[model samples]
Structure formats: structure tokens, C-alpha cells
Target: MELHEYVRLDGVGLAELIRTRQVTPPEVESVAREALKIADERLNGLTRPSFPNALDAAGDGPFAGVPFLLKDVPIAAGVPFTLGSRAIPDIAAAHDTELMTRFRRAGLVALGITTMCELGLSFATESARYGPTRNPYDPARGVGGSSGGAAALVAAGAVPLAHANDGAGSIRVPASCCGLVGLKPGRGRIPCGPDTGEAAFGLLYEFAVTRSVRDAAHLLDAVHGPAAGDKYLVAPPLRPYAEELDAPHPRLRIALTTDAWSGVPVDPEVAAATARTGRLLERLGHTVEVATPALDWEDVLAGIRGEVVAGVAPLLSAPRQPPPEALEAVSRAAMSEVRAFTALDLLRTFDAHNRVSRAVGTFFADYDLLVTPTLGQLPAPHGTLDYDNPRYSVDSWLRRLFAYGPFTAVFNISGQPAVSLPLGRSASGLPIGVQVVAGSGREDQLIRIAAALEPDFATAADRQGTLDQ
Candidate 1:
């Protein structure tokens, strides 16, 4: 098959083709490598291209022969695992993390590793080490980080779907930018062990960015079990995620609010898209209302700041830290400031986090879902929030980042499952995603709603040629 032919297939399509013997796994892989070469020339998304050795050990499993890419943060043995940081030497991981092991067992043929923000500390993909991972929709715009490169590659058809994880909107942010389905699973829904414990004390979840909701659901089915000694494990889904795609989603009381949790004015384009989606949901028999959890912004910010700052200290102990010249200046400066935060600060953050979680849970008691703009604004120009800029302090930088992506982190803070679906477009032709957030351990519900909303967004994006096959 031609590379273009392979690029158009979702993960399931490729698997089906391989299963029927229409294409050998090696043939599909060859086409995928060709697609990667072309996509990299245009998007500059990869930090490591390990194609020569990537498919060597992928054995017969359910998704046999499907190509995949990993964001650099996850540990993948024999693949360069630089976290878009110049502070670490360019070295391959000694072993795969438990999640990586599951990905391989799913029969995913590894393509390469994608770039990320330094230690994933920033909202933009202007990595000093790997340069920039640009938006696939418009190369001049930014692809949201720190899963930015993985999103870019998938969005541009380098691979059908690629591995991604979210801490503070990393997956959803980029998925919003590139017109893909990005589902941020609830914390501990997927295992994160045998290397590091849960990121940010269970604030992060591993998943993928895909062209369709069913693809996202299928991928989750392949990788959503607890590893043996996991510190925190979420309850298992009643059935595989794919099974939920066809199940009739009951009429839901969905709360729709265009307001940003952080006091930023949501972009008019984003607001209109969300309102439009609310109308669509109403027409589809779901009850849509205008309401949001009354969240304390200050507490939310404090807890987020605390978790992020505290998480970095442990990563530094591993591997040698490079000389000052090797690190981004902003990163080097923030390292000292974060280190100085007292343990009491972390305790306070935990307290604040618990408060927000309880509030969100209370709100969800009355409403089954919360619908909002995934991003507060449209995609920014490529150089908008450069982390290497010496002028912006950490305080000012975070404020700007929060303003840009205000809605996504609230769910992250509350540990709710949320999916960003591309349902609208800016007049100038940019993708705007509507975020659907459900109560904790309700990804099955979210996926059903996502499967319904998916077509509307795909249709909207296609009108602008962004989702054209």
C-alpha cells in the first residue's frame, strides 16, 4: 500500500488489514516509516527516530503491526528518552516502564520518540533541545505541550494514533489545536509504575490522540489495567472501552459554561463553538444547562503550583545534570525557586486540592457532565510563549499559560475524565475543541458522549479541510 493509503487508516483499520493478510506487518511498517519521514520534514516533531530497530520485537498480539510513537517522557528501552531537556545526556532507556511494556504487548510497532517541553514544564513546545513542535493545522501556530510533538505527528498523519499523557491539559490542549480526539483519563485509570509512581500524585494519565473516538476507546482497551504493585489503582471499567462506543448513552444532564475558571475571557470563537455544541446535544435528547462548579481559583492555582514544583525534585536525582549552558535559562532559574518551597507548601497544596475535588464532585452530583471550551483562546502563534525568553518570570509565564488553557486543568485538578472534541473553527481556519468532562471513574460515560459528539466536530473540521482524509 502507498504511504498516503496507510496514513489515512486509523489504528483499527490498519489492524483489520493486517489481520486479513491484505498487508504484512512489515509492509504496513514500511509505509508508516515513509509517512514518518515525510511528516518529520514538514512538522519537525520527532526527537528520536528509531525505525531501524523499532519493530524488531513487536510480537503477535491484538493490534499486531500498528505503528506508534511515544512522547519522550515515558521510559522506552533502546529509544532515546530525552524529555526535551538539554540538561540530560542523550541516552537510551535501560528498560521499558510498565506502561511501555503494555503498549508492546498490544502489538504496537514503535516508530520513534516525539519531542516535549523541558521536563514538560511549559505550555508551548518551544523546546530548547528539539526546537519547536508546530501545529499540524497551520505550521505557524503552536502545538500545545508537553505532549505537543506526539499530537503533531498524529494530527499530520505520521502515525494513526500515538501515545500521550496529561498532567495539566497536555493531551487535550494539543488535541484541541490539531483537531483530534484527546481523552485525558481519570488519574490511576491506567497504570504508571515500575519506574516512577503516579505523576504529580495521580494527576497524570496515559492515553493516545486519535482521529476518531472509537480509536481512542480501542487503544484504552489495549492498555488500561493496573500494574502489579501500583501505588494507586482506579476501579476497572465494566467492560472494554470499545464496547461502550455502540452502547446507547442515556439522556444526560450536561452543564454548559463558556466561562474560564481562571477569570479569563474565553475567545469568542471558542465560546460560539461550545454554544453550538450545547445546541447539538440538546437536539440529540440530552439536557444541557448553563452551570459550573463554584471553584476557588486561588486554591486551584496553589495546588497546581505545588504539585508541579514538588514533582521536579525527584527527577533531578537520576542521571547527571548538565552544566548551566546545557539547560534553558528559564528552567535553570525555576529549579532553584521550586526547590526552596517548603514541605508545608506541599501539604497546603494537598489540602487545597482536596477542597476543589469535593466541590467538583458535589457539582457533578446534580449534573452528569460539564461542557466547556477546551482552550480559553484559539491556537497561538508559534513563538508566543517561548520558555527560553528571559523577560517573563515564572509567575507571569504561568498566568499567561493558565489564561490560554483555563478550562482543561480544572478537571485535571479534580481528577475527572475529560475529552476534547474538535467541534468548531475560527474564521481564519483554526480548530476549536469542546471539552466534555465527566465525574471520576466515568470515562465510559465520557466516551459514549464523545462518540456522539465526535461526528459533529469531525464535520466542522472537514468543512475547513482540517479533517480531510
Candidate 2:
């Protein structure tokens, strides 16, 4: 296959071709390398390319010939783990994390590491460690982070799928910013590691961002499970995720909300996109009603901040010193601000989590899904959220981050499943993702609704263009 043709195929299609011996693994790797050459010159998405691994893994499972990329934060055996900061240099992983082991077992060839924010504390993908990752539709704009780099590569056709994890909106925000599909599985859907335990407040979930819904589905099937010693596990799906794509869901009652939880004005383009998506869902035979669930924005934000601070405090208190340039201003500021929270304050935050989780759970009991814009606006300019600006207070910086992604954090807090679908585009031609969220362990419903409504908003043709030029 030619590089252009390879770039056009989704992960599932590429895997099938490889399985049938229609496309040799070496041929796929060659095209992937060529695609990366184009992507590096344009998207600034990769921190380091793993061309040698791609060559070695070719002809290796169902996806033996398929090339893949990992987010910079995860420790993939033998791949450079930068964590999107100069603080951590190019240290190769000595052994694969459980997630990477699954990727290798599934026959995915590691082609490179994608960029992200330092410590994943930011909403935009501009790292002092590796400059900025540009959106393919418009190079001047930001690709959402800390999975920003992975999303850019997939959206730009550099790769059909790439590893991405959502702590706050890392995966979905980028999927929204670039035109792609990002699914944040319910808690414990994909194992993190035996040493790490669960993520902050059990809010962070690991999954991939892909160009097609089925690709996301298939990848989940390949990687979903609890590594022994995990804190908890999400309930297994009724059927395999890939098989669920073809099964029709009952007509769902979806609640749509355009009011930004922060009470800030969403960009008109974003509002329009949400409205358009609501219409699409209606056309697909689902009933759509505009409703705002009772949610305390301040309490939710405070709980998220508290969890993040408390979770990272131990790492921050360690005796080892960070290189001056390794830590960015935002992360440093975050570390400083979090120190003020007393043990009582952390308890209060946990109290807030239980309260919010129960409240959101009650709302989902009445509605099948809640649909909203993944972000309040179209992709912002690169570096707008960069940590170089010292004038911004920690509170002010966090406010800005929430404004970029208000809808996603709620699911994280509630430990529910959510997905961002590339169902619309901004007036300026950038991709606009519609977030579909379901109750905890109800990812099946979210996937069904997304697959049902995907065809109405945009077609595959909308994704093709001069991503590199």
C-alpha cells in the first residue's frame, strides 16, 4: 500500500488487510514511516519516532502490520518516556507497562511517542519541553492535550489510531480539537499498572483516540481488563465492544445542555455545533430534550483540584530535586497552591466527590445519555495555555482550563463513561466533537448512541485534506 492509502485506512481495516496477507507488515511500516515524515514537518506531534520497533513488529497478530503511537506519559518498554517536560529527559522504559504489553500482544507496532503537557496539568497541547502540536485543519490553532499529540497524528492521517488517556479532557479535548473519536472508558476499563493503583480520585481512565468509532471499539476489546491488584474494575460489557457497534440500541432519551457549567459564554460556533448534533440524534430516532442537571460548578471544580493536589503531593514531597527546566510554571504553581490544603480540606474534597457522584448518578437514572459540546469553543491558538506566562494565578489558570473543557470533568468525577464524537465542524472548518456521557459502567449505551448518530453530521470525506501542506 502507498503511504496515502495506508493513512486513509482505519486500524481495523489495516489489521484485516494484514491478517489476510493482502498487505505485508513491512509494507505497512514503510507507509507509516512516510506518513510520519509528513506529520513531523507539519503537526509537531511526535517527541520521538520508533521506526526500528515498527520494522521489527511487522508480521508479528491480528494487527501485526499495523503501526501505532503511544502518548508520551505512559511507560512503554524500550520507548522514550518524556512526560512532555524537559524535567524528564529521553529515558527509555526498562519494561512494558500492562497497557503496552497488551498492545504488543495485540500485534501493534510502536512507531513513536506523541507530545503532551508537562505532567498533564493543562488543557492545551503546548509543551515547553517540545514546543506545540498544531491542529491539522488549521495549523495556527491548538490540538487539545495532554493527548494532543496523539489526536493530531490520527486526525491528520499520520496514523489510524494512537494511545491516549483522559485525566481531565486529555483524550476527548484533542479529539474535539482535531476531528476524531475519543472514548474515555469507565473506571478500570483499561488497567494502568500494579504499582500505580487507581488514578487521582478514580477519575482518570486510559483509552485511545481514533479516526473511526469501530477502531476505538476494537482497540478497547484488545486492551480492556483489570491487571491483578487494581483498586476496582468496571462491569464488563454485555457483548464485545466491536460486536456492539452493529447491534442497534433502543431509542434513547438524550438530554442536551448548552449552558456552560461555569456560566461563561460558549463560542457561538460551539453552541451551533451542539445544536446541530442534537438535531442529528433526533433524526436517528432518539428523543432529545434540552435540560440542565442540577450541578454545583464551584464544588465540582474544588473537588477536582483537591484530588489532583492530594494525589500528586507525595510525588511533590519526594527528596529528589527536579531539573530547573524540567518543571513548567503551571506544574510548579500547582504544586505550590496544593500545599495549602490541610488533611481536613482533602476530606472535604472526598465528601464533595461522593456527593457529586451520587447526584450525577441520579440524573443518569432518568436519562440515557447527556450530550454537550466537549469544549466551550473551537480550538484555541497554540501557546495560549502555555505555562510561560507567570502573571496568571493558579486559580485563574484553572478557570481558564475549565472553560476550555467544562463537560468532561463531571464524568471523571462521577466515574462514568463518556465519548467525544466528531459529529460537527466549526464555522472556520475545525472539527467540533459532541460529548456523549452515560452512567457509570454504561459505556455500551454511549457507544450505541454515537454509532447511531455518526453518519448524520459529517462523512469520511470531511476528514481528508492537506493536513501537512
Candidate lDDT values, in order: 0.82, 0.80
Clashing pairs in 1: none
Query: Candidate 2 — worst ten consecutive residues by lDDT sum?
Result: 50-59
Give TM per candidate. Answer: 0.95, 0.95
Clashes in predicted model 2 = 1
Q: Return the lDDT, model 1, position 434.
A: 89
Write model 2 residue lDDT over 295-388, tens digit each, in one string: 8887788778875685457556756545544577777677667767788888888888888788888998899888899998888897777566
- Which runs of model 2 end up more than 4 angstroms from their true locations? 55-60, 317-319, 324-326, 464-469
* Candidate 1: tens digits of C-alpha lDDT, residues 249-276: 6889999999987788989989999999
* Candidate 1 vs. true structure, TM-score: 0.95
